[model samples]
Target: MQIVTEKLLNLGVDEDKEINESQLVLLDVKEDEKSEWKALSLNKQLSDARAELFVLLNGVEDKEIQDKIIFNYKALQKFRKKENDKELIVEKEVQIQTHERGDVTIYCDGGCTPNPGKAGSGIAVYRNDKLSELWYGLYEEMGTNNTAELGALYESLLLAKKESENGNTVEIKCDSMYSINCIKTWAISWEKKGWTKKGGEIKNLEIIKLSYHLYNSIKKDITLSHIKAHAGFEGNELADRMTMYTIQEKSESFVKYDKEIIVVDILKMRA
Candidate 1:
């Protein structure tokens, strides 16, 4: 109830209206019932009344202001729906829960600039509803898009291995089903042929093998899934951006001495 009250306060339900107590009643009542509170534009009047009440109580959040200024009827309904959902939370608590054995989800991506040029890898972890961690790094030495992508999956699988526990399900999601499939099945055949395989020298055998090892260790307790990227998938795009950002930074690999290196090289060649 405290959570509900705080949220209602956050949502800006007025004290005088006793909206918390009256809302269920009002919400259940028909549109005709609100006739006593009439306006020339009844819908507008109701919308304004609701917005004004909440904005007065919720202190006019930026999102609320935009909605009011735009006067989106559906948006108003959504706010009402969200408020009702919050109220439902008041009725939804379990007094006891422990050792939840959480479900983990990871989003992985990698990319390189100039095709085979500087590259980066990203692994973003989410537990339940919110994001937990993001692992992003660049390959200053040498890397390809596929290499970085594989590396991202490797890192994500490694993290999942670390977080894996008895009976808990961990889901790894990627835009690349190719990457997912590579680690899942191609590993066994590659290992059988001494990591070289008929595929003519499995590129990045070392990390691929390590990823296989981690996957095998946690396979009994994990679930891996491939998801379409950038369909407004929050974690996927976030991880992709992290990798892309790292890729952008990869071209400027050295910080303090890159110019000095050029100057030194020029002077040395002259000598």
Candidate 2:
């Protein structure tokens, strides 16, 4: 649980850190059916903890460290499941490949101060590991952190499209799992469901739609990867700094293209 606490702290989830960490450390038991329910709930908590740990450790290049983490994760998964449940199976192994020459990488981040207030997004595009372009902008109106994140991705995709025209593969690196999930995975289900979630209305539906469309329109190969925020990745760190700058300075001059200018205008209008 200390590891969980440390990971949450690294992720900037400070508000519930102490409480969640304490919950993991302490447990109450009673001899009744309610205790069975409590056990199930505790299992859920353990599963969540294991998932967070996996996310934090993902994309690690050290084979020894990756194997150890995977072993622990699989053990925890097995321990948490009921006897009647199917056994956990390793699906496909994930091999993290280093960015290759001629690969175009885009590192993007977005955030807001005081949630739903003063939101902004930033992007850093790299060509063959060299910084090619940088952009950041403030939303004209208040928006959630996810919106800012998606905005960064939207802009990055646009840049990727341009770069891909020269026959380079595009890889997008971002810290927002929500935004990544929306485009890469959940959008397929949402499309099948007529753009509705079972829980209710989907947030930022229009932006999601536009982003999904843009992603498919690009003819070149595109890859999306989630990176841990503020974790010393140079491009990601630069994007994060740009987001902070936009939030604090309220300036828009960092962006360079008329197309980008039009995109920001559309984002503000949609927002």
Candidate 3:
């Protein structure tokens, strides 16, 4: 309840008028029965009012303010669950697909605001063309877009290795050709020359090295390819959104996106 109230207040809903407005959104109540939706806006009752607002917004739609509140409420709930578990809780569908699916695809991306400011990485995983998992994090206080892209690619490699180990074919789609080349093409030559490039010192060499080794180990079962960014690919778009979310949330560690918490409209395809 405290979490709900804090989020609401943070989102600019700190007033008695706002509380009454949200309380009245309760659908379909007679004049007398509607009193049950009495506003709890007193200093002593503000907490209850905020908590009830969370519940009231559950099925309400199309109102911008209410939508934001509901979305924040769900996100906070998922964050709390993750904190309590101390582990990424794999969805039942993902767990069951281990042996049932033979193919998996992962789309990943990363970027920083102002080119070298706060950065984040995002990844979207699919099993037989269906979204199975979403992950975002790797928050860098001060980092370049390239570094963030490399971080996202490295994380995808980690996921790819796991899928390959499960006897599943994996394909990683990244929007950065620079990232794909660094691990798949350039790394081979760099490895032969003691990780040196005559041009200059390699940027993000540490992550490149880690990703290169992991990719080699899973190369037989995995393929890393480049896909154009913002080309209307649902998975890629979702991954990009996840990356932006990391910046908005300032999460330093990778967090699993709980679809049940809020619907990702971009992931839904149009016929």
Please report the candidate that would top lDDT against the real structure: 3
Error of 1 at 23 (Å): 76
The 10-residue segment of model 2 with minimum total lDDT is 88-97
Candidate 1 lDDT score at position 232: 71
Q: In the order shown, what is each candidate's alpha-carbon RMSD?
A: 23.2, 21.9, 12.5
lDDT (Cα, tens digit) per residue for candidate 2, span 103-216: 888999998876977888888777788865567774535777998899899878876775566567889998999998898789989999889889789989998999988987
Better of 1 and 3 by TM-score: 3
Error of 2 at 30 (Å): 62
lDDT of 2 at 225: 86
lDDT of 2 at 267: 33
Q: Rank the candidates by TM-score, best first.
A: 3, 2, 1
Model 2, runs deviating above 4 Å: 1-101, 251-254, 257-271
Give the per-residue lDDT digits (tens) of candidate 3, residues 156-233.
887787777777888999999999899889999999999999989988999999999988888888888889998978
- In the range 1-271, model 1's lDDT, one tens digit per residue, is 0212343433544444433323322233344554432222223313334444443433333555645544664567678867865653343222102224578788888877766877887766677766655556745446788888888888677656655643446888888776776779888887787776664677777777777888888888777788887787877877776676566545222111112223223223213
Tell me each candidate's TM-score. 0.52, 0.54, 0.63
Ranking of candidates on lDDT, top first: 3, 2, 1
lDDT of each: 0.59, 0.64, 0.73
In model 3, the runs with Cα more than 4 Å from the true position are 1-100, 259-271
Cα-lDDT of candidate 3: 0.73
Which clashing pairs does model 1 show? 12-58
